[model samples]
Target: MAPPTSSVELATLGHRIRHQRLSAGMTLDELGARVGVAGSHLSLIENGKREPRLSLLQQIAEATGTDVTDLLSPEPPNRRAALEIELDAAQSSTVFRRLGLAPVRVTKGMTDETLETVLGLNRELQRREREAIATPEEARRANTELRLAMRRRNNYLPDIEALAEKQLRAAGHTTGALTHRTVSIMAEQLGFELIYVNDLPHSARSVTDIENGRIYLPPASIPGGHGLRSMALQAMAHRLLGHQPPTDYAEFLRQRLEINYYAACCLQPEHAAVAFLQQAKKERNLAVEDFRDAFGVTHEAAAMRMTNLLTEHLGIRLHFMRVSGSGAITRVYENDDLPLPADVTGSIEGQVACRRFLGRSAFEEQNRTTEHYQYTDTPAGTFWCSAQTGTTSDGEFSVTVGVPFDDARWFRGRETAKRVTSTCPDESCCRKPDSEALARWHGRAWPSARVHMQMFSPLPSGEFPGVDDSEVYAFLDRHAEQ
Candidate 1:
């Protein structure tokens, strides 16, 4: 008798699991360990010679950095149906992509029924998009009309204020203390107040008080000022009539202030850092000092480029390191491929230390005493490089690259401290053999050894900083030479 035929569904699941694992640069043994299975068993499953149990399927999905549902339903999905589901998902959350589930499922079914279902879903999606698109324009027009009506309402401020004061007095406040300036000061202190103090250029001098149960602006006698006062008064009235003031005004004020500060930070240099990052993407290698000189900003600004690239654009988490002797470097930035533990030390001797790989020929030829190094370790293996920056540092700032090392690298070449050579001695060991202290000391000799990195995905258009991109590519390409 022939062997049992393998289920196509099981085959599909195995294929997807293998794909995700490979994409993540996980070895078969590593993946098997994560999934609680032997590598040989996983190989058989991937080859469709053995069916994975349900629990094993879950483990495979988790180990491969994918959703269990995605692994279970790995049949080729109908493209059109998948798109429709994706659009629906996007409507509810801006970060729908993080859901980690393929939106559509492919299976043997009724041909006409699937088509009709997809068609209906597509039509509904289009309707929703149309409504969403139209609502913003409609809101703009409504806002304009509302403003016009507000101007006409400004004539009633005195009456409104009188009524408001009466109510406040009823609620146990001295009416005499309710002057506009007093209220403005109180509102400023309270912080939750959203009262608009309109000082329009052409408008008359008036104070709009949208506080303490009143919607009023001091009325202006002149025509131009009257219209302006009316608008301001109208805005106050709308707020008073529509909603209650925040319960904790102080807290509200604090929150608003924080938000304002964040906005200011985002808008500073008018998005110059984001632009530079985008430009840097086009290039293979980037020089920090050159970028700062061109943009007229600080090292922090240039560093933000890399931060945004990794965290925002590529969805990668970054680890920051400030080596005691080495200035600062981005130690690690990785997606699912090479997830480093959060508590991993960002130092070479402590975890993974960076070693400058300056060529012997160049060092001998130039008699260069100091060198800068930058390197990253992924599951694929270690990558290293060096670069020159214009910024110079004293003993305060040293050039250094960040490296992620397991315990082995952290402890390697560390315990051997015998004075084998006579040329360099204790306290003046300029030519010490490869050791952790030697690496740290060499990094400190430079002004600033910190190398920055930005990790972002290629855009759909495939456009990036071509010159810098080429240089970076060349550096990576010449990794064997280094």
Candidate 2:
């Protein structure tokens, strides 16, 4: 199998090493002599034909009087250092000559304090320059930009996670389930009020009355000390982040996702989750149920936490899914660079996924279920996935978590070895039936139809049949005032 990495990156490293060697006035033979490697092998390294071991790279760097970091770092060593370098070089330009300024020189022994000072000065000047022509994003544009940003970022936001941790710490959040104390802390700290009612109109999970400084939720929102912590934390995040009323649907969706991520951070702190994953990863014993029990969260919640933390901490790529009882995908998150069979609109929601997949089979289950590990081999690669089928306030749903075969090494039950071939774009995988099987059973089986065929529409959409946006909006407006 190909390495679970990029050839381009490997090629880039080789080129960087070659460039450094030439700059040091060393031929392949000379560098190989210092590194104690063959000239032919060194040539391969210089030509991007082979990867060098760490010890060899160290020797080569030492031979060239350069640090190993100078050769291996894909980006600048540090942001402040890069800025200082730029700032120092700018003083040598013709523009600086016109200003009668002398060029600055950077030394190897430059202290972080000096670099920070340069960065501070640089940012201040840039801020001042922008102040004269400052333009803030309007709500609609802000939302659109935010959505694109999330897509580009694949929703793995470390900065937001860090801020959420700070907020959680300030709110006195501990390592367990969230409680009334969380709500009380937000109300006291943010000067907000929480009110519960029998039903939240418009089927909204929670609504905020910004003018009244009140947040409203349904009584059933939190079933236990465990539930609705995400909701409460999300509501708190909006206020904490100073997010204003959404100007457009994009903004609204972005704000919702942001707060939800903040809520997850509060529930499953990053450091703790990373530590847990590292341990599980080393043992190859990770399971959503185990995470849920360990973190005191639901199956779905645990699945989401794993997806968010794995990439950042363990370098494990994964895919997540939320499917309804009717084989419709409600939500998806993927960073594995694999193609998911989405609808014609380039969306998975409200679209029929592979019927043969475990998530789709979940609809027929009456009780909560977890599928045995299954593998999907497509043109892209072989992927292994497991799913937990569950129910929510609305109806039955399933959460499937997937990782490429290479990543399976870090998770539990990777040895299940249940392999399945999935060629997603083609219908033959699930849609086509064998002629002999049809001949054997088509007329032989006599199952009574419970519902009249005429009563069922040929095309059914979304989770619920009759729900409309305008109806939801009307209900929300009425509930907002209350």
Candidate 3:
């Protein structure tokens, strides 16, 4: 056999050689004399400190009366050797090195139980380190990957559409806007009841009590316009979709997206949404606000629904953006080749959109009541975009829907005279400061930035991201009696 290249193989080979030599009733010196090497050299090979040549291995095998193949087997000679090998690997790991602790040397005095305990502690340390490492960067990477997958399919999910349609049909919803009563019926059909509570967990929008066939939601009226119906539907979606507890941050993100998709489908039944979009397109008057009013959903939700349906049903491609007041792109999707700004990781979220784009420019408009339209010429191509500003607890944000120049003819705002050009991905665009102003203000500005601490923290640790299981359980226990 060739010399062992990995430490693991070397350790295993050393253990096997030592085992065979001991079974042959020979000391290290006895074996070394028979194999033509010094006793100390043999000791180094036995301790896995150095690799033995193939010729020496063959000589040792013959002297020990064992086949070379037997000596080369991968299994450790005993459980003690296996534990020692595991400890050797753990001590050499990056996590171990980061601790700046000295490696624990294996000695004859160490017991198997002590080795097992140390290995258990190392495993727990590694797990905690991994949980801590699930930071915003990991979230961005996961979001970027999810966005790419959604983009490949034009941001449409046929399975979710079918599910929504099936549930709506069962709920006797053949109509205009989905009613709260209909949403309740859909949940009932799935063996779940919507329970309103004042003490819903702070971290959760809604929680499902699968054991009691109940979903706990905030105390909002059922038929009210506070998105209570959507919340209930999203909670029930977990059970309807047969979702398991998410194992990682990526899985958590995927489940959140899926549940949100299901909620949107329920809010605007796919068949009705497609027909509404089709008729709007036929009249060359497609507008997101009209769609939003027709479905009784928010402007942002309507824009997102358009992303889900336009390419799949109306045969028009588009992009969507939700930009914060500070110009950071909070949510984004594009299959229309719009040159949205992105970070080095291909993550668009948290990166600022160009001030010239409709997403940012709309925020500056005095007439925030109506959707603002703009034509932006980017490196990829020109896009006609419509943006509407909305305010939430987090402050102002703009929801934008845009399409390629050719597809603009099918929309209502194609004739808007607001046109601008952007050379984003270049510092001279909106990102760079004015040269003359910079020269005047150099070393004069000392403004403190508002740090978003949550962004720097690791993702909340639990089976469900951002949820506290103990609080949820206590809430459920309190409600279960009623």
Indicate the worst ten consecutive residues by lDDT in candidate 1: 458-467
* Full-model lDDT, candidate 2: 0.68
- Across 359-389, the per-residue lDDT of candidate 1 in tens digits comes to 1112222323433443434334443323233
- Residues 42-138, model 2: lDDT tens digits: 8787544687788888898898888777777654334543554456544443334554655555565877677667656655654443333212222
lDDT of 1: 0.38
The TM-scores of all predictions, comma-separated, are: 0.24, 0.59, 0.74
Q: Is candidate 2 or candidate 3 better by TM-score?
A: 3
Best by lDDT: 3
Q: Clashing pairs in model 3?
A: none
Ranking by TM-score: 3, 2, 1
How does residue 288 of candidate 2 score in lDDT?
80
* Candidate with more favorable, higher lDDT: 2 or 3: 3
RMSD of 2: 14.8
| Positional deviation of residue 247's Cα in model 2 after best superposition, in angstroms | 2.2
- Winner on TM-score (1 vs 2): 2
Q: Which ten residues in a row are the worst by lDDT in model 3? A: 217-226
List per-prediction Cα lDDT, in the order shown.
0.38, 0.68, 0.88
